[model samples]
Target: MLYRGSCHCGKVAFEFKARLTGVVRCNCSICSRKGALLCAVPHESLTVLAWADDLSTYTFGNHAIAHRFCRTCGIHPFAEDVREGSERSAYINLNCVEGIDISVLSIFDFDGRSA
Candidate 1:
């Protein structure tokens, strides 16, 4: 399935092919603060439709995940992680997805604080 998403101000928009297997809830400082529900997909499966100069990146700790956000609205639309010995991953913030009812999806908790 192809899902479309955008930031709060629509400064950044993207689409990806993914079936929402499960939503991920992370306990890390950033994740907890954002209260984001993320859906993981292959990096190659994502396509930025309207992103131009409106995207900004933030990284912390080991800088493994590149948290991408809309500079204008400060909404984190998605995050990209490139891990060693593994395929690159794109975690889309389900909150930004169009016509998604998160309450219907299975949720999984990730203990990112311990990592």
Candidate 2:
């Protein structure tokens, strides 16, 4: 499946191709605080469409997952695997996805605070 997503303002948009492998809910500081619904996709299936330069990145802890947010809206649209040599996967913010029915999606809980 091809998923379309964007920031709150919709200035920055992207498309990813993947059959929803998994949705992760983390109890980590950032995720818990933001209440984000995360969905994972392989590295090759994801693509950024427009205004990528307008996005900003934030890292914490060992920074295994590089969180990317929109500079203007401050909404986290997608995450990338910029962890040095790891190109395993990318966890996208399901909250930013558009025109998709997520009612049937299954979610997994994780403790990323210790990762």
How many steric clashes between backbone atoms does each model show? 0, 0
- Each candidate structure's TM-score, on Cα atoms with residue i matched to residue i, is 0.94, 0.87
Query: Which parts of model 1 are misplaced by more than 4 Å?
Result: 83-86
Query: Per-residue lDDT for 79 in model 2?
Result: 81
Candidate lDDT scores, in order, read: 0.93, 0.82
Instruction: Give the candidate number with the greatest lDDT.
Output: 1
Give the clashing pairs for model 1: none
User: lDDT tens string, model 1, 15-77?
Assistant: 999988789999999999999999989999999987778998999999999999998999999
Report lDDT (Cα) of residue 57, candidate 2.
Answer: 87
- The CA root-mean-square deviation of candidate 2, after full C-alpha superposition on the true structure, stands at 1.8
For candidate 2, list the clashing residue pairs, or say none.
none
